[model samples]
Target: MFLISMIIWATALLGAVMTVWALTWAIKRGEFRNLRKGASSIFDAGEPIGRQTDFFPPVRKGVR
Candidate 1:
């Protein structure tokens, strides 16, 4: 339908405009200067929790 096509075209145009605006803003604000400064800060403190579970016995396929 004509209405559906027009809606899709409008959406695509709006998305493209927003993406360009974001990139330009980032460049102007120097947000891309530090590429990896804080990239590893999340894992710098400690490992993830609750990966080990000895509370329950291991699965036995032959019995259960």
Candidate 2:
């Protein structure tokens, strides 16, 4: 149905517009201005980025 397709397209376009609008609003409101600080705030230097146990591959029970 052409009418259904048009509605779907319009809704998708509207969603995209809203997403861009919200992102712009956040940037204008200074939500993402401190990119460097935000990255550092997430982790401490003394902690490992990942677990040490992940260094080795798991053994397969029955490989062909």
Candidate 3:
């Protein structure tokens, strides 16, 4: 019985510590600036900044 109780307490303590650590790291990294920032980051803004065609140019036919 004692072993079971100890295991439960240890699990609870570990979960609490992880929660606290994640919150602290997020606060330090400015993750809470705005909720939409996370969603917006998934989108692309117009064309890419660099030349993308360099890697994926169209192939010419009968050029050989």
Query: Which predicted model would earn the best lDDT?
Result: 2
| Per-residue alpha-carbon lDDT of candidate 3 for residues 1-64, written as tens digits (9 for 90 to 100) | 9999999999999999999999999999989888786756755666434435346555789654
Return model 2's CA RMSD, one decimal: 5.0
Better of 2 and 3 by TM-score: 3
Query: Which candidate leads the pack in TM-score?
Result: 3
Q: What's the CA RMSD for each of the models? A: 5.6, 5.0, 6.6
Report lDDT (Cα) of residue 5, candidate 2. Answer: 100
Ranking by lDDT: 2, 3, 1
Model 2 lDDT per residue over 1-64, tens place = 9999999999999999999999999999988988887776755666645534335666788953
Q: What TM-score fits each model?
A: 0.53, 0.50, 0.56
Residue 29 local lDDT, model 2:
91
Q: Candidate 2: TM-score?
A: 0.50
For each candidate, the alpha-carbon lDDT, in order, equals 0.78, 0.81, 0.81
lDDT of 2 at 49: 50
List ranges where model 3 is wrong by over 4 Å: 34-36, 45-64
Clashing pairs in 2: none
